[model samples]
Target: MRAAGRGGPVTRAAVLSAALAIVDRDGVEGLSMRRLAEAVGRDPMVIYRHVPNKAAVLDGVAEIVFAQLSVDVKDSDWTAQLRVIARDFRALALEHPHVVALLVTRPLATPLGQRPPAVVRPLEDILTLLTQAGFSGETALHIYRALFGFLYGHILNELQEVVERPEETDEVLRLGLHRLPVNEFPLLRELAPLLAHYDGAAELERGLDILLNGLAATL
Candidate 1:
């Protein structure tokens, strides 16, 4: 549906694209129907014609981001394909850190059948990848769940390592780990140096190694 604006007819894609920009700039909290209408240069009431409400707009924004994740269903090496997908997914999350929360939490709120098609496509494609590689549908589904569960955890963990004092030379000060009592949080304080230099890509590869190796053994 196109909402007639002063400049031209704003397609639903245009409306959602504007919504995505708002989310990318100010995050999910900043997005509202009113702001979206302004972004698209339309009346606030006109937004209702494109999307029913803020929830719908939020879902559309998520779909726009998730659409970037590509799946190679034809890749015969299921494990290798999964590794590539995992890395690509990680890159996508890092590229749009603000959208990471939605990427992780939206599924919990949305039932499988109710989720946006783009959000669900990766799952379907992965299932196809595994099943085509000789795994049963049930097992493929389990692998899919396990892989994504690990990914979600990894991404959230990666994004949470915010450096409080980047300019500080001391690792503890840099990570604000020194704020915790040295005696009480001995282990955490001791690891401050290691924590300060987080290598998200290396960490992701390590996790994929462990997870994929373990999953491979079962097959």
Candidate 2:
């Protein structure tokens, strides 16, 4: 047990900040109440004073990350606002790759009211944006769902892309696409060059263009 120091009391924000750091360096599994307390220079039991348990800590870490997400409910063009959000969300995910899992899955497990305020704030703001743009409450909810579903899928796919041999000059070798049997994956192997040099931002924009166009047709 270490002292939290004579500087100040152990605040929730400080605890969560330390937890986020541990996740950033070592992923979710690296965090524990004991480790968190140690990071903040407090006894393991003292950590319970700020957060109930590891689950709460996880929620807090996720909340801290999501608190940085900016949403403008007053943005006149809902489509353009969504575009900005999509790009910003992508950048946030990239900034904290380890926390992406939490951002995506935490809300699914927790009920809307039970989730952190910061986590739910964006949902309320987006709904407000669409409804003010003349969409019905139900329609606004659907639009929010549709947009986030696409964004979540896109971010997950982008993050999973791995270059087996990044230094390899040959595109096929760079992506390890050459290892596939020629007969079974001819097209995939042929597309090795494209796969090796993926542009996530461009892909996101193309997806948004298609999605927004199709969604607009529905209204």
Candidate 3:
């Protein structure tokens, strides 16, 4: 199973999917061209034929996760569409926590590699929403950046806690409430349990409402 040439013909998508599986199982550190080839049962050089190097392979993994976000933008209202997109994005990130670090660190640009077509429609949807909400192209771009940044930060923080303290729920709770002094931060202290709980979908909806509502006010 470890041998590179043990498998069959490999397509680019197959290779990327195999690489993502490796990351999902063992993390970004565990992924390599050779290992990916073995995972897909192909020649190591076969993977190189599809992606130039390990950097490209890592980028491909991110692209695969993005590809899973199959949002139907045309079928929904702008605000509802944005919330669904945000929720789906968060779900994908959480599902592939091992890729969270890389996804957060890299910008979605040509330098990282071209994103899959799956991202294009969702992105256009957000831009359309911003434009419909009275933002210029420049402002739409800023809003897109702000929304993604907030979602990514929130997901990454939650994932890091899950990874670093898998067996220590109390520790995770303590860390989450570290900023609060019990006496001075009574409300926060009282609500720490609720606050520490990370509900990606619910939070995405709430955040989207806040953003859209604020944008509506301005418009």
Candidate 4:
């Protein structure tokens, strides 16, 4: 896939897209310059020429994932905007479960932090929402932390579910119910069905509402 490097060489976007496809199929561990080269029908050296190394490749994947989120705070209500952002993020993570673990553990400052310009716009929108809601810069930062923590936690839990049990059986639900003594955890057992059900979008919207409402009351 080594395009002529004279005038306009292989664009970064093309390289990143190929990398994301690799991650989606083979996961972060399965990724390597050689594998990426084979997937893209390029020489391994050409892959390196576009991205400095494998770490950079992983970062590109993260950027690609974030780029998929569509949130516009200027056009939507602050709470509505935040809910959309959270939901979109949750969906993206779930779509690429293999990459979720890498995203959680990797520091943003690493390759991931070098996000494409498109990724920064969504964060700027979120920050703008927080400011409009009467939060100080510090408080806005804290809100951001809480918002992401909730999203990440939800995605991580979903990833665990996929890994531990590929099949969703009634027995799985019963095991969780058994952990809570019926006498002491009557409410929990009664609500087990709702609790066991996985709806990342709905849960994300609910959590966002709670977080924004809490922030509103505090502010």
Candidate 5:
């Protein structure tokens, strides 16, 4: 019943998936080796065989989250590829808001090169896309950083705006926008109807067009 580094790679993957399920349902805080084992029907001690520690579990969860992003760079031009990747990434983050928090913050805790391969692959793909499209090594990294930074920022902003908000009401008062001082925030107050129907994907597309076009024109 105890897994002491005994599970093979497939077993480890299954354990990681179970860990992800726990994160989706209960958030990262609710994920413990014991909890993972319980979710996967293993002894609490057994999960450690698959994952060395809590840190590894978190990293594995991050790896699993990253793996969900499927970007097809081969089928399109650089701009189109990037658009697909950007939209796919934002969609995945929205799908798993709790796991996305881990995805966004884990880089602070672990170095990029030292991260798991799955976790690092998306960056590598982007860098490849840029290099193939004529960006030099240094320029590619810079562009990747700028692009990913905006993507990450957009994901966080979207989560904050949409995650905890109540179901749409016909009126803005239900969104608590009515609480703001009308004089101090006249435009935002007046735009409540538009804000009530926030479309993150559309805004992200518009912003990306600006960012990517600006990059193209600049470089």
Candidate 6:
């Protein structure tokens, strides 16, 4: 659906929002100026008036995603605040599974200085958290890399767990992992039951424990 207020002025927010929904229903490749125009009941030129090109639309989409993350680290325990933001990111990725790929891939193409303000806001907030916690500028940058890298990797890994049948009880059966020959994949076969019952939040928390604990000692 187009933004609820698309009937009014041709707002940039509406255009970006419609693009996000398009990306949600159809992957980013499916989003085009013409398609966005159709989604918002406007001409292609009209859509262009709001966003110069598809790349800008995507940048806006990224901003929309990163904006969901809490950057407010002031007057709170650092670890706890980071955990909240990490969990928020995990939820956002799951909600927009298709867009998650763009989240990582887009940054490689866009330079740091040229990135959208909304995209940079979270990093600045993290820097605030790290510096306030006694980390030097260089150390804070390293910590940001370590923390965000793990968070991104975790989201990818978690999403790769294919639940072929949600109602199914058997792990191997649920994921269709039983097709492998028992002799070659013996351990994996044996662990099927345990694997099927994977809890992403619990697993992420365990990883956070190790990562945050190790980082804390550096201060």
The per-residue C-alpha lDDT of model 2 at residue 94 equals: 92
TM-score of 1: 0.92
Clashing pairs for model 5 are: 3-46, 5-49
Q: Model 5: per-residue lDDT, tens digit, 1-219?
A: 222233433378888887888788888999888878777776777677778998888888888889887656464487788888898888888778888878888756987678988888887888888887888988888887888899988888877874224664644564676677888888877777777677898989988999899888898
* Best of the two (2, 6) by lDDT: 2
* Per-model TM-score on C-alpha atoms: 0.92, 0.93, 0.76, 0.77, 0.86, 0.88
Q: Per-residue lDDT of 1-219 in model 2, one digit per residue for the tens?
A: 122443568888888888988898999999988888888888878789989999889898889888999899999999999999999999999999999999998877898899989999999999999999999999899888889999999999899888899889999888887778889999988888888888999999999999888878887
Q: What overall lDDT goes with each candidate model?
A: 0.86, 0.88, 0.70, 0.69, 0.79, 0.84
What ordering of candidates by TM-score runs from best to worst? 2, 1, 6, 5, 4, 3
The 10-residue segment with the lowest total lDDT in model 3? 1-10
C-alpha root-mean-square deviation, each candidate: 2.3, 2.7, 4.4, 4.3, 3.7, 2.4
lDDT of 1 by residue, 57-170 (tens): 877777878899988999989889999999999988888788898888876688899998999999999999999999999999999999999999999999887799999999
- Give candidate 6's whole-model lDDT: 0.84
Which pairs clash (backbone N, Cα, C closer than 3 Å) in model 2?
Answer: none
lDDT of 1 at 36: 84
Candidate 6 off by > 4 Å: 1-7, 163-169, 181-183
The TM-score leader among the candidates is 2
The superposed Cα distance between candidate 1 and the true structure at residue 112, in angstroms, equals 1.2
lDDT of 3 by residue, 104-195 (tens): 66435454235555545556767776676566988787767777877887787666654233354663355455555677777776765665
lDDT at 48, model 5: 76
